[model samples]
Target: MRSEDALANIDVAVLAGGLGTRIRGVLGDTPKVLAPIAGRAFLGHLLDYLSAYGSRRVVLCLGHLADRVTAWLARGDSAGTIDVVCQIEPRPLGTAGALGYVRKELRSGTVLVMNGDTFLDADLRAFVASHRLSGAEASVLCVTVDDASRFGRVEIGPDSRIRRFLEKAPGSGTINAGVYLFSAAFVDRFIAAGAVSLEADVLETLPPGTLNAHIAKARFLDIGTPESLAAAASVIAGRES
Candidate 1:
């Protein structure tokens, strides 16, 4: 099946509930996903990207100022024709836990999960093809960056199987791009808690050879910090254009 077809057949979960402590000073009450990017909420660009891939519905896992996000979604300026729903976290459920909270709501065998604060200009078709060919329960999109110091590196072997996860250090390396495709069973089994992290607690602890690393060269943007947030407008505009 085409990648678009695959995406159309699955559900997408956007983990948008993090406390934007890093960018809080600049955004104040604005949720990270709602931070204005090129005069629109950053989440708008994210939804646009997914829509381009034939995604019809998106489940937004919200927390920490989730009301602001829901209000924006209601206005419907950015969502266009996509079906967007908000699943407000009862509390801060970390990354993995938030997905766990909405696991039952997801209605697909395979699901796409993304961090709401980051964007990757990648080929979803190729990534999806890799995941299917590898037969892994989960796949992490990995990107090579000039400086992986700000992000933890994902170590993968020659076969593209994830070997281990490395802590952030000053060096160039392949880092997790924060986009993941997982089998629903994997989410239910490993990410089944209300206070777990997708990174440290799950991916990092998973046994080697169990996860696939879908490598790609893409323009990646993370709007977690003030400086990165400032750069997002131009990057988002360029990508959307």
Candidate 2:
């Protein structure tokens, strides 16, 4: 579905709380989101993309040198419309914990969540509309990836409901695109499960047919390591040129 018609009332949550342990060798102490790509901080590019799609509000879940992020966002003033929420996990609380920490703030309606380290050329509107219409507790953005061995792969049933979630297996399949549209209630359930992976803690635990998948048409990039970051930079540069 087209973005214009799909995401009329959804809020966006960008998970930005990682330590960047993998890329620290290259970026040294810089938050991964602040890593330079195409002459601007990577998070800036993400915010620009979200704004382009008429995002109602953006909540950035920040941690690990989060002060730098706050200062950077403050200096730009472009993020004034974006809500910056801090999720300072005493230690890495894993992905689901960060979301749980902010459950109260996510007090209403469905929310679109994306990992700070990956990018997908998805129709956000269609993703959200599909989640709402499916009546599933959660909807994951999925894409066919050649190297499913490095990512969590999801299996959807004939009815389009998620049947199983496999994390980083040595095989090929449709993988999680690091983007999701979830009903608020589903997030609360994730919080109740304690600190664990989103895929392992929540997606895997859902009863059959409760979770759905929305296939996207965009290129997918996971920017977790230096190599992937360089690849993402090249992709962004080519798009601009």
Best by TM-score: 1
Best lDDT goes to which candidate?
1
For model 1 the local lDDT of residue 40 reads 86
Q: Candidate 1 clashing pairs?
A: none
Go through the candidates in order and give the clash count of each.
0, 1
Residue 144 lDDT in model 1?
Answer: 95
Per-residue C-alpha lDDT of model 1 across residues 106-133, encoded as one tens digit per residue: 9989999999999888988888889999
Error of 1 at 29 (Å): 0.9
Q: What is the C-alpha lDDT of each candidate?
A: 0.88, 0.77
lDDT of 1: 0.88
After superposition, the stretches of candidate 2 with alpha carbons farther than 4 Å from their true spots are: 1-8, 77-83, 170-172, 238-241
Cα displacement (angstroms), candidate 2, residue 30, comes to 0.9
Per-residue lDDT of candidate 2, residues 37-153 (tens digit): 878888887876776676656777787888888888878834444555555556667788878776666644888889988876666777777777888778888999777888878
Candidate 1 TM-score over all chains jointly: 0.95
Model 1 residue 141 distance off true place after TM-score fit, in angstroms: 0.3
Alpha carbon lDDT at 78, candidate 2? 48
